[model samples]
Target: MKKATMTKMHPRCNEHGHTVPIKQPSKASLAQAWADPQGIATAVPDSAMPETINDVPVSAWQGAPTDAAGWEALVAGLSFTEPPVPSAPGKKPAAGVVTIEPDGRVWVVAPTNAFGGYRHTFPKGKLDGLSPRASAIKEAFEESGLQVELTGYLCDSVRSTSVTRYYTARRIGGSPAAMGWESQVVMLVPISELRGITSHPNDAPILKALPAKAIVIYEWGLASGHRVLDTLAGHFTRYGEWPTRIAIPTGMHEGLREEILSPYGWRLLTERLKVVATDAGALCAYGARGQEHSYDTNGPVDLRKRASEWIWNVDLT
Candidate 1:
């Protein structure tokens, strides 16, 4: 049998019998050394390593000291601070809530000291020992001073190091004046406008997912009212754009026509209207013909009739 050529590995110690691996500069030590001009002396030169090993320098290693105290001092001089940010092992789970009110307004609070310049967001906090739903409700009350009932689940997300569960809630009682120290002020904003005020972009989608319903004032006898409403619903179904509030004359007349046509292009002169008319005669003519035409049953005619006998509310919101 042919004798095999054996490659000899270098021993842990150098020719001077000094420990080699023990003196290697840690990442923190290397960073500190780079900051100090004298650290260039301690850094291993690229030429120190053999030409075979990817031409990479054995940068971290250094010659060990002779005296025991000197070795201890060199080891002490090394640092380990440059590791990744440490997270607490086995951190507890957390929960938060998105609270809404009965009037299509959502509850949000401004923290006393906001993060990333975010002043307005839905109430959220760490979960204690309670269930996620219970914790969410508790957080809502504690942060906004409102007692809320958990309606349904909103979403769950990993925020920072904690996995937080979110729930949808509705205010039942209490007032913003009773808010605890955690929040500066509690605000109730219309759901449509919630995204504009909230500083956190992540919270905007939750507010957007809520149903969009408008309170439109329309007289049952007016064919123009039905025409406008049916067209609006069709537009929403096709494009997913909806109006949160709509206003129409309780009964059309010369005054109403003048108001609608007042430099606003008859108000319905926009793309939403099938036909644009400036005067009452033209508007009434459209309405008279509108009654004879067939419309989609899926469109909200019955819903509109059910909500009919409408009162004139001064405030559309």
Candidate 2:
């Protein structure tokens, strides 16, 4: 019998800058890793990573740290000027990226010695004459050594010194071993463990904006008038979070629609309803006469067309 040969893997660094062999995780192991509180942590090359790249300080934000007092002082000082000309009144515009892997793990960076009061945080920096999207892409690569493609805008975070725009992204290429000096260590954390790892108040809103295992609710008139509210309330009660997306019928009363969803902070979408309806893993449809059909299949374009009423897509792991 012939034996299968395993491919040799590359060595990466740990938090202490010690070189260690790392192997690619299997699907089963990746799922297990996501559940485990101690997610994957890898360190970048300390000696190789440069302190300054292209005349920009690798440790970037030299203003106050992210503490409450520091943040207040930073904001107050912005109103005053040194050379008789005051700087911009508001926070500096910055951009960052939050990269998530296919297996549902988030990539975070550990700033060197908790610089700018961030021990573990997402990669972000000042715009530096670049657009928000472009700056986010640049910062993600520079801090984590990972090439990422921006998928959607996440949220705008008002930090101690900057108002940073964050974008959701997926990893394309690159390795953590190539991370710049700004990040002492690179970590691949699960969404569940994100809050625990990052304790700064500035990161709370960004974490809240992250997508979760949600049931996208779609309703016309029947479900909207009867079961939609119950379904949304039940989901919120059970999971402590609202559904990802909700689609309403064309003729539903505008005031009623707003009253039902606005209180829960669900943004109603009319123009992009079809686009949201099609991009789901599973869907449940409600007929015009209250007939119902639930589907646990992917790519349900045909089912969507045949259904007379609204459709709900539940993300199946």
Candidate 3:
């Protein structure tokens, strides 16, 4: 089978002032561009692309060898560790891909109306003698009709029949209109709506594994600290986890260290929490209960406004 060609290349300048082809758009830039109607043209599309190149599926027709040694060689440079949650006993190993488009939308597959108890989910299947990376690539094409290149490991989620390792990927070629018989439809969904659309109980861990687009940072106070903590706790209870990203002032870190790190499993929260040093004048003193305060620094102000979702500050005097 003939291999599918990669998407058209665009030129970009590097630090050394040499012009080089930019392989993929950064997630941040994609998110920003998605907001503008003109930016829709910037997104990669499969307009003239073929569903299959020769007899093989376009997604799996990479020019590289499909053997075990070949797959191992391809992933040798990638750095990823096993997830903290171990595979379930007596379950098989599987792999999946979460393909994000250039316009910042995520690809999800509808499994022929709840097939295998899945209404909508990421494309995935058993390893079937292939490496996790290879299996994920093949499964993505068969289930979602998208050729994906794995960028990074997201996490491993233990499901009813398998311990599936999920990876973050970007669409490189192929078209969703060519989805296989297993899938009824393929959809590109916004990140904010992913949690609501892919609402299977087993998918909670996978959803949590996705990186947050923005984090909320606030000053801590004797009275307001507890209120913020209560708000965070409530969010956790409703969402099944704390915000993926959080930041606090350095001075307050010591005072709230145990409360923030102990009960929720330090291993999980440590990576998400950031203790930053703030200038004395950067933050205003707390005002009235349930009141909001704005940041004095332009950086924080810009971050709050630019974030796609979830940004707020609480202050009390």
Candidate 4:
């Protein structure tokens, strides 16, 4: 067939004495190879593979590495590694608690080695490997000499889940003589007088997170019919970005089955969601205006809602 002649690859992909079919080149194909830095045309000098200017080698696209390790290595060689931080930081070993009494009073424990003067403020303490509540109980007993039960979710503060549950525990047992390392004295005061008390740097965080919830709940009830029996989360409106919430009802969202979610700016929000499990199965329902939503750290509870999309997360157990 007076076909067009061709030049050899010089070194075939096979190590020795082997020849594969000679492939023809196309104009559109040639444009792509010329655009690639790793393509055969770029590797060969002008003296060789003159025809490669016309097409990508079949090998160029074939038998690509089955794994990413090779690509990762190539990227590593071309990229710079950021130097590590010179100073390694330490993480706090455990969590602490602040228990206030029912008469709006908290027994502040004084630190044993006060940096400058005698220090005293609510019964606060740290948790070991045991449950947080259990540790709080032990510390309160040891520090303030009082045994009690934890009642409510006071607030969540800090970046690393330093969630301290403030309990309104009745003094079930013990006395004021008990003490621990860095802890010596304990006394009580009304919640209305919380801010007036002297505080340590760490104490400030707990106080800030302390919920003025009694008032917020009262306001929610006055404004809307939804009487907030408890607050599951807090909302602030300092900036102008009003948060939009979409109620996610648990079922299963089938593999991003629709493109509509993005256009609507759908986001999974933790603030207003409630997880409800029942005889039927586990379901996720979010707070609706008609339905009450609370994020009390006591955790979200599914009360009820209307006209909200109820989808399921199949991975949910």
Query: CA lDDT of each candidate?
Result: 0.44, 0.52, 0.53, 0.34
Better of 2 and 3 by lDDT: 3
C-alpha RMSD values across all candidates: 25.6, 15.6, 15.0, 30.6
- What are the TM-scores, per candidate, against the unseen true structure? 0.41, 0.48, 0.49, 0.36
As for lDDT, the candidate ahead, 2 or 4, is 2
Candidate 1 local distance difference test against the native? 0.44
Instruction: Return the lDDT, model 4, position 288.
Output: 35
lDDT of 1 by residue, 249-299 (tens): 344433334422221223223323334334322221122223321233334
- List, residue by residue over 57-148, the lDDT tens digit for candidate 4: 21222222233343233223322122221222453333344654322344566554342353555554444454444555555655554555
TM-score of candidate 3 relative to the true fold: 0.49
- Cα displacement (Å) at residue 197, model 3: 1.4
lDDT of 3 by residue, 27-125 (tens): 112333334322321112222233332232444333544466755565566554444436588999999988765334577877753677876899998
Local error of candidate 4 at residue 286 (angstroms): 34
Clashing pairs for model 2 are none
Off by over 4 Å in 3: 1-76, 80-85, 213-317
